[model samples]
Target chain A: MGAVIYDRVALIGLGLIAGSMGLRMRADGLAGEVVGHARTARTREVALQRGLVDRVCDTAAEAVEGADLVVLCVPVGAMDAVAREIAPHLASGATVSDVGSVKRDVITAVGPHLPDGVHFVPAHPIAGTEHSGPESGFPELFEGRWCLLTPLSDGPEVERLARLWNALGSHVDVMEPDHHDLVLAVTSHAPHLIAYTMVGVADDLRRVTDSEVIKYSAAGFRDFTRIAASDPVMWRDVFLNNKDATLEILGRFTEELFALQRAIRTGDGKMLEDYFTRTRAIRRGILDAGQDVDVPDFGRAVLRKGTAG
Target chain B: MGAVIYDRVALIGLGLIAGSMGLRMRADGLAGEVVGHARTARTREVALQRGLVDRVCDTAAEAVEGADLVVLCVPVGAMDAVAREIAPHLASGATVSDVGSVKRDVITAVGPHLPDGVHFVPAHPIAGTEHSGPESGFPELFEGRWCLLTPLSDGPEVERLARLWNALGSHVDVMEPDHHDLVLAVTSHAPHLIAYTMVGVADDLRRVTDSEVIKYSAAGFRDFTRIAASDPVMWRDVFLNNKDATLEILGRFTEELFALQRAIRTGDGKMLEDYFTRTRAIRRGILDAGQDVDVPDFGRAVLRKGTAG
Candidate 1:
């Protein structure tokens, strides 16, 4: 148990991020009270049923009222409307933050709508599963994950929020909004779009039946499916909001793909081998950094057996 | 334990597939003796030390001597030379098979080298981890995985090999060589190429530091790195040997990617959302088929914790 960082923390959207935050905060006594609101009534009901929040409010405006810290956890595209809805209701001196993947677009969308006294700290916790919804969240969802904060201004509020994230088992790093978007573009947005595209291509291939793709997916395609299965609306908003950076990365990806494809066509084994060998080093770096599990097959075979009778 | 399927099984190349096959066969008493041969002395030493083989032969010819089943587990490009080297040494009634990823190429490369009485059954077990080498294998590696056989002729040898795969814990399927190549191109080869290309692009980007990419990979890019981390020589050979089919799939993938990119550029939220929604069904299909574990984040979070303490 940790000391309460905020007397009241309101989460504007009851999806995975909000649900996880509520659960972690409540579990560790990081906040005195956790309030949550969702556009859909069912989400709110589930959020309450799952103990993701101490109180479920009917509206975003109602959720933010009297809250010491307000978090906007909706899709990037919905940030502006939620910001507008909560701005007038936010308590004076309250620190406002977000769990949006793209920072620049979120800042552009939510900054102007905030009241002068309210602190807006745009943040992206670089952690989540393909699963979404309130029920999909767990208290340990953000454990050992990186929480990137792109603050408009540094103050006690930002430090307090960082403390909350730290208590929730995240390492906090501050980055500029533009750099955050570009970094996420390379790490998350572009990879997701490419995965979605490849999975879509596999599904659309008439010769390869869906069952075959599903059955033989363990041969590398399954990884893409897991990634492509992430919340569609959230990913769509990310791509749209971070359009330029995502496209730029994709363009480079295509150019590289063409070069590799040409090597395959021309039977240039050396070039293909060299390129592949280079990428292996990066995977090693990620594992050494503890960003991923070092277990073979991501330990899926073990997981499968563990779930079996 | 199951009855011995073969009097003696010889595994050439002694890499991931061969090592796993050796381990399973020995563990289950499926083969009377599991002998292995690797191109490198270090791999042979590791195979012996790891108990991946009962005996590590210095040369392919010595390993295949008197073996009832000789499995070519080498890279696609090395299939021809290995086949030629072992052709004269193969027993008169021995069954010769392979664990190659691309079927048609293996069939083309290995077909003519076999003796008249030798049974040529080219098999591809669609199972692996990103980790390779002799030490990476486990007895349970093939549990519930699919092993596709592209045989040149139908006989008792083919049925016996299928039974061996089934005993090793894989569902056996038979398909034409060309069709198998195309299906794998869509499911494995092309996806791997795409993952490799994306990782290469991320590494090449001057704006995103390698450290930032590694730290933030859990957002999505880490999955691609796992795929990209696969054995370079094997993947390079896969691309080279399955050129036509892989290139065709890559072409389709690029077209689909461009359409999605345009949607992002033009703010076609509906199209983006719809496409993403459709891809989600494939993931569901994979889970429903039991090809992938339904656990969130592939249960990586749990695995990480398990390893920690």
Candidate 2:
């Protein structure tokens, strides 16, 4: 266990990200006490039963009462409501952060609701699985993963939150809120939407049938299914909250897709080959950044349950 | 190792599939002696040095001379040429099969080239890594993977070839050529094209620099990079040869994507949530079918360089 970073930390949601944070914090003794609140009583029961948190509170307000660190782990769409609910109860010098994919929206939603003394630091951990809920979290989900922090003001609280994420086994980087949204639109948001659309298209295709698509998924569609299987409410909120950036990326994607479609229609092998080669270099860069390994089949077998570190 | 399935097997192109097949066949004693041929002498040398084959032949005809089974493992666009090259050398009663993603194209390209006495069974193994070439093969690549065999005439030769694949640790199924093309368009071909297009779009985006996309790829774009990093020549051949099926699936994908885009533009949260929920079920079916695992992160770690079996 590492040195304690917070006296008491409250997570406003008991889903995958929050549950994982609680588990990792407890595992490493990053926080003296880890408290959490979920909207549903069933999730709270599961959190307590699964040892995801030291204690489960009845409401977001009660959960943040004396917590020095309060992380809003609710869906992006619900950030403002949850922030307002817990604002009056925030500790005197507490730091309020989040684990949302889109940063700009979170800033706009949760910023005004937070009290003046409470520090607001918007953060996005570039780590997750398709699974959600209290039972779907593991301690090492953030290890070797990037957690981006986009702070409104460069304050000591931001550094403290960075240290906490470091203690949680993440490499943290500070970025501007708008830049974070645009980068995520290119990296996470748009790719996820595309995956969902492709899977939906496969479902709607009568000629292929659903069973055949599932049966032959190992070919390539299986990867898309994994991404598409992520929490529905969470993704819905992400798309709704990050509308402008997501739409911009999607627009670029559609244009490129059309160009490639034209090339395919005209049987232009050269264009296809050139485009594929340039994109291959991007994978190499990701590997070089240590974000992933060099294995060909995506190193899939090692990151599964019971095997992950 | 099991009993030998073929006394002598000849592999036409020493790429990923052929190399994996040769290694798996030898590891399981599925074939007595595996002979291989590649377009380049360097690949032929790598094939023998890496022990992917027992012997390396300079030409395709020389490789197929006395073999009981000759498997064409070249790209889809080159199948016709390779089949013609080895046609005269195919032994009497020998079965010639292929490992192409598109089956209808393979049948049209290689069917008439085979002599009357020789059997032609087109097959595609629904398994691969982004890495290609002779040195990339491994013995366990085909274990628990599906191998589809599309035979022109359902003869004993088809059964024998199926037994060979079975011994190589693959579950074999017979599918019609056109149906195979359609299924692949939905499962493999279309998904690959989509991934490539997404990666291409990211590369073309001026707002998000290439390095940022690579550094933050742990989001979802990394998955597309893996798919896009596949051999350019092979993908070029796949798109060109499977034009009709791929274009059809692409049209369907575009329609679905436009609907989702409209929903996002209109701020229809319910539509997004319901669509995501439906796509989530497809993933469950794939996991239930044992085509993939329930492991959330795609089990990526186990297949890394120093960690895999």
Candidate 3:
């Protein structure tokens, strides 16, 4: 929308987030040179051919060379290696950040490797889809979404770089790294784990029922399946990276789950009614807060994808 | 599409399902005459205003009189009272059916009171939206959806009625009444209860942090809360009716949930990975089965009412 924020920006891992970053930067005229890197030559070539970046480089170091900003868009597990690889090549005073789902994990994994002169800012853009690869990223992905930046109190330069996200198209929030992880574990990770697990259970039942699972899934199981179809490797990395917070929130979830099980087992209609009534209110609050885009029904939206049944 | 299947079709309650039935019947010329009735006069007025039925009757008895087909379309808990109110007035050769969530309970509640010559067919159309009332109905609601019918085999009349649904939009599947309840409990009722419970837990957390439980519900919580917002009285009746099946399935879900909790607590990334991977296949199967309609995400189909957010 205005002059470029940085003369050159390096995107490590030309996957969904990075490719999307490239698209967004190009659309908004935010970067002079959008350099993308992938370890595999084939992926790097594909990224270049697909016009995902102004330039393609096979190594993170090459991509970061002379770049004013560097963004690590790989899985959280891969952050340290990329950080170390690109650190020496990053321009002096260049700001480095990421689009990792877990903030504290990224800081721990990538922070130590960043050079003193290159500012390191850890951030998480709370948005995505099940699709992956360079083709999946688009400029509009971050519009109106929350981008949380967790910077050390003394790191003013890094904090300023984090504000670039707000300039691009995001509402910025500042939170302690650990708090970010804990809140996400409850809001996103745990819920995903539950959905993935329930879908697996339903699939197992489908086998015994001679394929009735998919047949009748429209009744409920289909929603779980759609979420479960997410990129497995990325989710595995998320759980491994943010172990403690996930475990903490999961404990609370199970305690509540068991109480519900008890209500169902003993036919405590009153408890069920009370619990159900309370939850319905939460949905209303969501609507009032405008956190959720109003969709008539999840199943109906699923139908629109038209990719699946 | 063909000659009207029945000379007269009486819809006992003009809510979503019943109104939908009337629309579908008119669209395909599946009924010779469509009559609507509701417990309250206001609903009848709304039905007539919406042209949901050809004739709006003042009483349930008046609606059922001389109709070749009668459908009881009320909450599962109300099956007994509605059935009794309309039973004596039903024409001798008329076939009576229902669109309830729980099969055994509907059959139990409505079976004994039916006249000797009248055929009783219990059906559950495994489709709905969070919104209720006459305005929620649409002709395409049951398109490509499964309709489960549990009917005694002795009557040719019941078989003819099954043909009627086959002529309409639904794919009809017949099963044992008790087994129907069990299957639905596993696939629908139990999941709805768990969703309601989890949203309740999240709602409690919202109270403490004043967080946006509904607003920022990613995929899992968003989907859960959407299903949880289903009609409270209808869900309560469903739970009361299908207590045994729901409790049995809830037991299985809790056992699985605790194992997952333990996996998270112990930092067993491999176990979590194993479970998450297992679930992705179900999405593929649903996609292959053509049951889950795909949308951008699992956002709901847009509703014209703009009432339920």
Name the candidate that leads on DockQ. Answer: 1
lDDT of each: 0.90, 0.88, 0.77
DockQ, Cα level, model 1: 0.83
Cα deviation of A72 in candidate 1 (Å)? 0.4
- Computed on C-alpha atoms, the DockQ of candidate 2 is 0.70
lDDT, candidate 3, at B134 = 86
lDDT of 1 by residue, A1-309 (tens): 899999999999998989999999999999999999999999999999999999999999999999999999999999999998888888999999999999999999999999888898888999999989888988888888899999988799999999999998899999999888888888889989988998999888844464677777765788888899999999999999999999888888888999998999999999999999999999988888888888877787888878853
Question: How do the residues A1-309 of candidate 2 rate in per-residue lDDT, one tens digit apiece?
Answer: 799999999999999999999999999999999999999999999999988899999999999999999999989999999998999889899999999988998999999988778888889999999999989988878877889999988988999999999988889999999988998899899999999999998888745364788877765688899899999999999999999999998998988899999999999999999999998988888878887767646544334224432
lDDT of 3 by residue, B1-309 (tens): 767889899999999899988988887888998999998888999999998899899999999999999999999889899999998898998899999999887888999999898888888887777768888887777777788888876578767777777776678888888877777776787778767766766776776446744444566777677778887778888888898888777777767877877776676778877787777777777777667654434433133113343
The DockQ of each candidate is 0.83, 0.70, 0.52
Candidate 1, pairs of clashing residues: none
lDDT of 3 by residue, A1-309 (tens): 757778898999988888877887877788898998887887787788878898987678888999888899998888988888887787898888898988887898898988888787778887677767876766666665677878776566665665678766777777789877777776788777777766656665665576776777655566667777887778888888888877766677778877876765676778767777777776776666544555445435334445443
Over 4 Å off, model 3: A154-164, A298-309, B154-159, B298-309
Best by lDDT: 1
Residue ranges of candidate 2 with Cα displaced over 4 Å: A206-210, A299-309, B301-309
